[model samples]
Target: MKRMTTLWSYLLTLLLAVTVSAAQESSAQSLLRSEAPTSLRADKTLSGFGYADRNETKFNYIGTKKDLGSFLSEYIKLPDVGVNKITKISFPANKADAGNSYIIILSEDGNETLYQQKCSIIEGINEIELTKPFVTESGKRYLVGFATKPLGIDDKDFAVLPFDYGSDIEGTSYYASSIVPYPSEDNDTFTLKSPKGLGSACIFVTLEEETRLQTLAYIINVSGTFDPAETGKDITTRFTVRNIGVTDITSFDLTYQFGTGEVKTIPYSLKTKLKSGKTGYYAFDIPAEGDALGAVHFAVAKVNGETNFFANRCLDLPFRIGDTEANAIPRETVLIERFTAEWCTFCPGADPFVNAAVKSLSDAGLRVSYVGHHLDDPFAQPESSQISSYFQGNGIPAMAINRVPQGQTSLLMHPSNFQAAYWTSKLLAEKRGVRIDKIEQTITGDKLQVVVSGVAFQRTFDPENLYLTVILTEDNVAAIKQVNGGANYKHDALPRLFLTDALGDLLSPAADGSFTMTLEGTLDAKWKREQCKVVAFAHDNLKSSLMSRRNVYTAESTYLGVSLANEPVALGQAPVVSAEDGYLSIVGDVDCFELYDMSGALVTTTVWTRLDPGVYVIRIFSNLRAYTSKVIVR
Candidate 1:
């Protein structure tokens, strides 16, 4: 009886010990999430991304290209701990399809693959355990992505949720066709692009932690001026660190290097404790005497005097320390492009907001120009089609501010948001260094020669992607049949001609940052010489950046007859002129009305009999306007 009691007690004690060990293991494990999902799932309605095509051999992918095999990825960041093990990964999937899904990890540059594993996928959410776990190093970025291929004849569709390391955290999701596990890097046919309208692929990674040590820091941002004046001197490079651990951190060890050069370590003690999930700002100096196209890599090596903690380091991309003496360009004009069609009845609803915004912005001491790209209308031109296609937006009455996108994917937005977009794009333009100082146009015989002179503040580096776009738009185009714009509506700012390519002519800035480009074209006989204006601007046309925004740095306009010698007229409020129901109303001070027909014949009559059921232009002459507007009459 005594032997039996002793054996039972031993078994009970062993069971209790095993249970306690499991409880400790569960307590040590915590979920580490990536911020990519916030931006990816920004649109909650979208569940997942994939495609179903009849042609199995042809790889189908969305965003920017047609033939490339796309690999969409998200970014993941882990906290600092000595024993950090990524045990498993989870992703959302459609229950209808089954295939082989791959979990890929790439280095920060997207050039080399650190690790990748393939797993059989199931319906709904797939939680797959990694057969071999991978450990991550501190102060590094890893791009974790999901890819899939058809496993059998029954599996018709393939897709995995996107993963992004949130590099630079520009709220952008990336797609690469040349990266490994898809195609070789030398396959120049496919380039890295962040497609528009597609959000992040929400891929969750599970990490098991084993350490009692608290307090960790991550380098969030690294920035500094690339000014040539600071050459050979220690320029102050700003660093922003965040305490991502549970406990507050008081100090950390920072290490930095420029372009793979010698690494230098610095220990910093903060004046106040940086609380958990809080950020601290610090500044360090890097010698500015190296190559003009060099990047700085920085890492938080230690936190709170502990080396086992995990922290993310940052790699700052190449920057141009401008060597030109020219000052940064001041924003002068905000170009507003409107997409409209005479057939669209709802397009007229947006006219009030657009007109109001133009007037309001101009009245506030800023120059504004409105260009209407009429689609499928009587006045529609081929050039307008190219511009419209470049914007890649559907629906009519959409507006774009300075050719810059208002959201993550498109340059066009509803007209109701025009005023708000103007202010936002205005602030962005002020930060750009490209400026159009002057636009010179001279008429020689039937050909009009245009010389666009500007200062693009890129001296040490070449501005290869920058281009100069010159557009010829005509105002007061009569004889149009509009839907909601009454029986007859005269279109203004119609893009009649494009002297350069629809995109733009590539610009080459001189050593001093000044650039000049000439575009000459024979004026069309149908276009009215007095009503046409020349529009010129400098813009950046990089494909990767175009996914989110197309940076239109600066813009300016000049009338056909205007020369550089002419002084710019300082104007006041625009004349309130309206043409409705065959009646002309002018409300501004010191303005006279002159009417013209489609044939360019001046009308001196007050009789309404001469005005037929066609479009008419009522030109108002006023000193308050640089160039008075032409009203539309039915």
Candidate 2:
């Protein structure tokens, strides 16, 4: 009886030990997860930095410019000090048929090759799983690098990695271009013997382990249909959210804070199951009150009752509330950016088509403005190249309408679709209360001065995010070696100069929602003053998915040197300009006024009565019109 009892106790102890071991094995988890992205923005563009050539190899590291410095061999210090396995690599490429590429991982000191693998390249996003996963060590930093080679077809076939110029990383990207390919697993050398340049090529690695069952969400886009809110009315905003996690998103919460107001959290329950890698639209409403000008920003606060920093995306929504009537016609203007080149065979045919489209819009009682950008041609400028890359104008004879997001249409498209695209955007474009009230253009000697004033028909909510972009375009200029068209072909609306940054310059408006800016640029000797026109437009850096990379609210164009002083003046219609009691008052419905000296130099965009007793040109600008008259201060 004693021996049987002992045997039963031993069997029970063994069974308990086996159960505990199984529980421990279940607790140690492994899940597929991606590292933090080099750029968090949804949009990326093809960079004109350089093109890959046959027999040429380029090595690059995606990181801040400060850390990369002038050296080609730069390493990113691994932030996490734990056991993690890198199983896959992903990146973006400009060309679909790139020949060969490789992903390399170097040791902390950059003297040893930890892991390397050859990856097949594709046009958009390319994902490659490694043959053998690299296990990371604790307290050891690793540097990730990529090497690429061009197709052997021709020298300039336009093959390179798509770059993200707007990355929020610490420093600029670093690269080394070499005539010969670097040997694989060469730990003897730490630096490359090639010319170096700046370019960002983002690469995301897939880790095999992190926290258990990670949940991530990416905010894809926001709606652009949010109109100006009426005072005391609730304004609704909608955004598209995607489940980028391994697990399904059952519920989530979004938080928004308008200006200095209190942050409000709104919870959302997924009626339909949002599986991994799927997207859904959610809407929320907030009361529009108390603030006149401020930004409304939203973020993903929590997912499934847990949160991570990567879940929230930065989205800027500029809001406005009007004190006027609830329903008002939005001041609409169509902005066209035409991409062309002298060597393009089909580009000349696109000119008349665009003009016809513009004329048709004008006939329909719509204002249309356009600017031509030359690509890889003699007339191409740095600003033109920059703008082209930002908009991803990969091909010639492309046009963008109003910069509003099209469902699947690119920001730049073929000329054949310009009319249809324009109409599509016009029909769905959000109504903006902003308008260009007045524009003043003056040419003195070798310089051109422009003043653009704007006003909101309703109260504005965000003024700081409001921006204005001014461009000087020349008309009827002789084409430089036209390819399809004859030598007599004249280029119209060719971009001559950008008075502001290619994107725009921020605006600071008055309390009454009135703003003004004065821009001056040196006139090129080759440019004809009479053929030049100044184009100014108001746009906001609104972080909405429906809006393109940028959206133009309203745009206005005026011919240079064609001020009211050059035309026949009507009595009483002109603004009454007078200088009295140390105050310069222009009694009229003028939105803004500027003072210019007799020499055609701009003095001020504000009312200034401190001028000495002398003859001055007072230019007053109103909605859809401008007036110029000579005034004397005694």
Candidate 3:
């Protein structure tokens, strides 16, 4: 059996490698936020970098200064936020030359000059720097390129050739002109070519959202309800705090209120810094009001006392502990990313199983967030290939269940396996004591307005930094040609647009005051507006790889909602729940359950009295999960 022993050893080694890889995935996610600013490429609204159209024009002649250096220049429409500074300009050239004079001029949509700077170029592919920076307001356009003197060298590339990229859409070519001095001439003799609707320069500039700070708070988990029998005693309930911010959370003042009672303030000056995207907890032994049992309790926050980060900032949540039946729901969100391509015949086999699992999870009250990333598919997006980079695979039909168990991409296409992955993810998420609450979306004209809110439930847990991504996905493309599924593929949850950064908008502790955000979306005509959905999530971006791809945050994570062992547990599954004879009883997980009237009023007393009840809703809970049931008392 020596051969058998060797095979067993090999299997064990493979298992060990898979385990190590899985563990490294989550820790690796923090790399995105940890990367240096200079190393990561900045996100720009308008980039001439993608050389989609290769209409290369050779430099013929350089005109006099009065003509504004017209040998070669690529004018582009600046983003709505306009241009800040043309940091670096890379121009591909045909040949090398020393001290060739060059100039970069900015104008308003092929209009008069707004800003102009002339410099010298070297050889082929030169990165020219502007002597004086140019800045302009939103809704502006500018021409950015180096106008050079006649090099006299034939068949050579020159300045402003196109930023080394291809097939990616960015901007368009406005006009190309050849004239003795053309601001005076207005005829066909001046216009040479225009790659209208399908052109962009080899330029890159900072966008609008790039400047705003992305620090905010998420209320993860709020647990435990008020009890009346523990009269004159300190009744306890706890909530979690997750610091999803850029900087550390050092100090803050918190205000707590139980139901409609008097407000109590608890302020703390901490010795240790609470880093970003980490979870923490707070427990309160609120003095029992004995009689005022069914009122709502919550916490309101005022952040680190920084005015710039504090304004328009708020984080508040009101929840019931063993009180309201409606407040006991703590469902988890499962992110499922499937990697496939039309070329892979077996890829279609996985989709049916995965989608069926999603339905089962939904029916069970679990939120399943799913997306299919196309690899080598005709409908593939650049971001789809980027999504594949998160998981390890060389073949098709691979799936990532919340970025867990990496190196396990192959094998198994069954609904039960899908359910297992989803439920396991849900369980892990619930264990983290995190919760996403209150998502509001409104579509006005072309702009879709959205607001998202959340909170933490365990002890404070964050890494070096954190960011939150809000996504809008459209369902069922309807006409996609599928090789295996059918002629038409009902694509499930295809990502259409990102309200924030694909990498994610930064979140900070200052947002703890209310931990809410508002985003406006300008809908694309390609997306079916009626079938669109919104998904938002937060993660540690400190060690993230988003730096390389301009901060496009990939939700295909391996470890989400890190488990918090010491935190409270779900009370819904408590076995000792019983209600009989017009009296509702709750013990271990809950002290008691309260009955609400038809007008949404609490009608209860501890005198053990019989109710003249018709029907009522009973709300019960601790901190984790809750269940509400209807009962008729006669």
Candidate 4:
């Protein structure tokens, strides 16, 4: 019995020693297993990983053989770290590793005393199902395990699970839908683990009814006075386009037709897109040919291969050729006597009648001259007032025939009838012996000097006080105001300028029957030379008697061959520059010439008359022509 008792004691001691050794061996195995360092951390919840305090419960972890045993003695703190937001998560299908399972653990501290419950991972992404969700007070920590076992099999070969729990939590919930292996019945279930912020929403819609082109047409018309002598005048016509449809019309081209053969195409380049309701205007000018009526038509062509025509609008303009007959007809000078005022209302009624009478007489080979005396005519010139004062007419609508009072007459017919009779009577008498023979005019710059030399058979007027007066007048003046019938009214051919004294000038009729005089004056540059006319008459200073008058003159008032100083003539086209040998020729008329460098400074004035072989800028003014063109000046 003593020997058996001793043997039992020995067996019990050996058994206890073996149990202790096994526990120590298991502890050694747990320590030897690969694990994240104490510095590593993660968050199992949507709140991502970051540094955790050393004392935080979520930071503590344990590694031991027992189901939940502590291995490390002290709590380990993890440094701050972060994981990128997950864009997508993908897994493989039905492969050898498809049925793998994993265990995930998380901790904020490295102490072996504190650890969260393990999470089971399925074949695909197996979101953690939290009984008590892992809350992150400071940072986060996690551990993952992947294992696989077939049905009814105990052998397990766990695949290495990537420790990317921090990556699973995305800041934006709008992550791409992932493709992963099909989950089995045992491990397919998953939870969001923690709530994440919602993503932004988006919406889209379609547009309806695009813009379309509608009917477009160009219409042109010319309406103005026509004269035979002025053939190159420009007649302006207005063009307008209207949008006729409900939709907006965009770009369109306009083709203009002038007469039968002349055609021009104008393109409309619009900066802004036209809306549904809009209209545009185009003003074009057509040059007037001599004695011909011209018509213009417009057609619209759209960008989208569409064309439209509005009605055919035609213009009938009358033009005349040759000189006016009114100027050639024998003129019976009729003295127009009239009294006028600015404040009189009744004077306007008689103005038109007088004007009509003058026009009629003029058309019928008669020359009518008028002296308008005004008491308060607002637009009356100082000269007109002076004439009225010299006549010494009392009351309004008073008149004088050739500066002589024709008895006080209220009738408007008095001036017209008396003046005509007086002129006819004087012409029929034919008692004057002196007659104008010759008159000549020459222009130098802006100065006009006229030389008048004539022969006289009889010298009856006073030689010392005989005065000569030159009058310049223009035809076709519109919108002129005058006084008639005790009122002020508007008329035309109201004398523009009277260059003479009350008793004109002295002309000594020589015993040799010859006389000569020179008249010089400056004319306004803006005056049209073509329409200008010069009239010279003789008057006596003593008796204030008329001697002789003449209306023959020359000098183009419309086309001044020489332009004003510093106001160069604008060229209507670009000049072509040609070089042959060492000489250069510029073949165009330009307003000015200039040469500039790349820095845009005026280098020199290019003299067309003298230039070395080089290129230059020939600047011409006029909208119908180019402003500047490159010309080779050699």
Candidate 5:
């Protein structure tokens, strides 16, 4: 009896010990399951939630009707129905062997529906979508679970279990899946559906704390045009900025650093309840009076508990200002005199070429002054008559470049040669003795006080009659005339005043020394100040004659300087062509000619050496470069 009793006691103790060990193992399994990995919930509710884990036999859950009610009160509001409903479930076909077998069961009160939906999950993240087409009653609740082992026949093992939803729960019930024997880590996704009126909820199945906050930064680009000839200004830098990120950017500051020392800062305010995506523009203009070579930097910071900073850097922009004084005045001054008459027949033909030459030179930074002395011209003055008489000729088309007759030639020529001659004389005369030290011009009422100082070099050239003449010319004058060449001759640089021997009687004594002279005159308002010029020149009056004066020593002068003389030649008029010998030959003293296309562009501006068999416009300028004509080149 004693031996049997002892054996019974030993068996009882063994059974108790076995029960204790099983309980301890079950507790350990639960703890391990609770400590599984998880992920933060995404903003898209219907796209199914994803969580990282090492557990292989784990099932995800949609918050039950009761849990959702508690969630709505504790976390965020529910989403709309369309965004909350799960449309269809899809899984990768290639991962069909990665333990993808499962069943979806719905329970409302005592009514339970088992859905045999198959899934193919890979060893990585697996997505299990559910098409819960049926709606649940108001008081009904639902939950999902994963079984460690196959479910038992009894309902007691399927009861709800305790879980940690990352926070303390008040009115929510604890729910856990049955313990299924599998690996400790896995990845899974779950989708849920709800009624149209009741919004959806997002579930975050995380096992650790979040370490990083959502970060955002932005950059701005700017471009523009700045012309130096238009505005004497330059831009240092340009930039634009906007809050182009998911988080609200507060206390945003933009700084532009152009070159080394150019820097500017601007502060801005941002939205407080900033959502995931929003944008705003911030533009800044560099101050007109700032450095032009600098870089631009942008910095953004969130005004939360601490400053969260984001920054980006950009380069500087460089531009030019306006045209400088040196570009406007390249050479010294040159004086040009256009001697013409109202009754002159061919004078109008030469006007355009002369005017074009003057304009081209002026545009090239060479200061040129012109005078149009009209003789027998309805607008001619006694001074014009005296000047014409001084030349000892009654020629209608005459020009005195720098007060020296153009080789005493009575012919008109192209203005281009005249332009070249004038430039050459000016360049050569810059080193001559007859130098103009300074010319100060001031107008007080009707009188123009011009103080001009002329210094002669120690060595004089020839023993002859040297005379200094000062002539005043006005611009923008209009006149109507009926000349034989063709009426409507518009004239510019009309000479209004002239002075003989303004410096002295003449160098008749042949003195070899230096001298200075100042000349003054009065002008009326009929002449515009901006379009007037004073031309002064010294020449040998004895050597100047009408017929036998073959050797002319007059230098072409500009407002800037003087040029050596080029013998002027008379350009002949176009001859009347006749269809003879299958060729057209020019007649008369046609020293040179040019052919232009119908568009008035010069095609061949050389000597009239060869005439092609085609229609063309022929331009004839005198060797003096004073007169011109247009004819057919055919």
Candidate 6:
């Protein structure tokens, strides 16, 4: 009797310990929730991305090409489905892994492997329905993923499938290590990781955009130059607001952060409904904070009474509140980099405009730089792709004017008025106080050395505030083909190496506004050694400012900043561009000019036409190069 009682007590204690441990683990895991519930709703599929193009039909793998026995995963917050009714788990399969994949469910912490669907070949998306489904709880994030079975040395187990780590569905991809007990689900341990950059698993989850009563608001952009004033003094600054949602609203909350790390929110109550797609100007009359060199400002917009997504899309702006007394010079050289590809159909037209913009700006005799980043094609190497990816653009014809992605001509906007755009951006960036001197590059054998120095005139380039970035680009790579189907294409200013990081590098910020740095790199055999040029720039890490002047390879100016002078500014008698009334009249000396719709499709136009009110990119070309502009035909 004594022995029986002792055994029973031991069993009960063991059961209680397991229950408590499970509860603790569950609590720890629930922390992995997504900020948005769009993908956790019932009856809605979370496959590929929310975009139709990213469904199972498309195949772009996330991990190393298509290696089987490897893991491809996404962190998903599974919604509550009643009594084990959430039966289906589906994902696109690259034809190779048609019948040999293990569907898996991992714990939130990704420390334990909970369940596995063995031989769960995703025949088609939603084709393999679960007979006895694994139950999921609401508000709990889980890893819903798949791992391919390793083939017997001779076979390839991995194949292409849908994956998108960028765009609206950003929180989806999570990296997972090799599942323990490789071919078996019996092993209960694995690690979950966040993908690098926007990440690379070609995966998406289907979720409703609205979980309950959620509406998204975006703080489109804030643009204005601050006036000369002292810190601690109140200055009235106005910003433009846009209603991006379908429903009109009456009130909005604007938040801007001060240099002192204080965040201030201003409320704007409107008398009239600010309809969707409409923009209105709003102001915040508040006292300025921080010193004369300038205080970096971050601004965000949110709808009243709603926790919308606008808060995440805030803008960081560094502007001086007072006169330019401390700073004496502007940014010396502005680099205009256009992220383009031969596969981009819109690039042909965009190239002319971009080059023309450079031409127009350089015509003023300003020290402007241009690099055409040929990407997504054979003409450009992987380093060029890295430079393109650093900016994280979703579309082509992306331009990073001045190494720092600030100012007007960024990838977000169309390449319409390259000339005016570059010039305007140059003027704005040139006002900064920094100078680069004694820039020299020595290429010995396969090793290259770049030595340069910088001096900040107005403020300090301290480690807390600044970093350095170096890039190498080559001219005349000799284009093999073109996206517009033209054989006569010449690729120029292609990036061969990022001497520093693709984005930037950490440097000891100068105490007295002066600094020097040395960078070394190995030349790739495939790269044209003699044609390469070094491009270096100084940047303010804290304020996100690109010093107006940079140290660049000074050997050759392809455009010579003098291309426009040889040709007449007019086509026989017509002005380069002019607008009167509702019609925009554009004419130039060229064989032919083309107009394109925003979609990049070619459209027929008659130079001057009575058209609908909208934005348009007009490309006027001459034998030397093309001039582009965004004309608002109102």
Off by over 4 Å in 5: 1-334, 359-367, 389-394, 402-431, 462-464, 480-490, 499-514, 542-634
lDDT of 5 by residue, 1-634 (tens): 0112232233222222222222244421221111212332222222221111111223222111221111101111111112123223221111123332442333422123333344433322334545343232333333332211212122112111112222111112111221221134121111111211111111221111111223333343454443231342434434433332324455555555433344556564554543322333444554433312112233443323323333433422332233222212122444555666667666776676676656554443334556666665587866665545455443546554444344454322334346655655554444333444344466678776655544443323222344555666655566766375344435566666663442223533224454445556677767765555555555444333322221122222222111111122243333433323323355544455555332222456554345444334443434344223324333
Candidate number with greatest TM-score:
2
- TM-score of every model? 0.43, 0.50, 0.36, 0.29, 0.30, 0.44
lDDT of candidate 4 at residue 435, scale 0 to 100 = 40
Model 3 misses residue 491 by how many Å?
1.2
Looking at model 3, report the run of 10 residues with the lowest lDDT sum. Answer: 557-566
lDDT tens digits, residue span 1-634, model 4: 0112232233222222322222244432322112223323232221111111111212111112222211111111221113312111121111122322322222432112122333333322233343443222323432211122221111121122122211112111000011111232111121111111111000000112112213333232234444332556665645545443334456666565533446566566656544332355656565554333223345554532365433333333333333333222222234444665545545555555566554444333333444454454444545555544344333454444333333342212333344544444543342333344444677888777766665444323323444565555544333245323223324322334555553346677777756777777677776666545555544434232111111111111111121111122344444654546534455665555544321112345544344445443333433344344444443
Q: How far does residue 188 in candidate 3 sit from its true spot (Å)?
A: 36
Backbone clash count for every predicted candidate, in the order shown: 14, 6, 73, 28, 47, 24
TM-score-better candidate, 1 vs 5: 1
Model 6 quality (TM-score): 0.44
Q: Mind giving the per-residue lDDT tens digits that candidate 3 earns over 3-78?
A: 1223223322222232222224343121000111131222312222212222232221111121223343444344
Q: Which of the two, 2 or 6, has more TM-score?
A: 2
Evaluate all candidate structures by whole-model CA lDDT and list the values in order: 0.56, 0.58, 0.44, 0.36, 0.37, 0.49
Whole-model alpha-carbon lDDT for candidate 3: 0.44
TM-score, structure 5 vs. true? 0.30
Specify the poorest-scoring 10-residue window by lDDT in model 5.
70-79
- The segments of candidate 4 whose C-alpha lies over 4 angstroms from its true place after superposition are 1-347, 352-381, 395-401, 404-426, 475-491, 526-531, 542-634
The CA root-mean-square deviation of candidate 2, after full C-alpha superposition on the true structure, stands at: 19.7
Q: Per lDDT, what order, best first?
A: 2, 1, 6, 3, 5, 4
Where model 3 places Cα greater than 4 Å from the true spot, the runs are 1-331, 363-365, 375-378, 405-430, 457-459, 511-514, 542-634
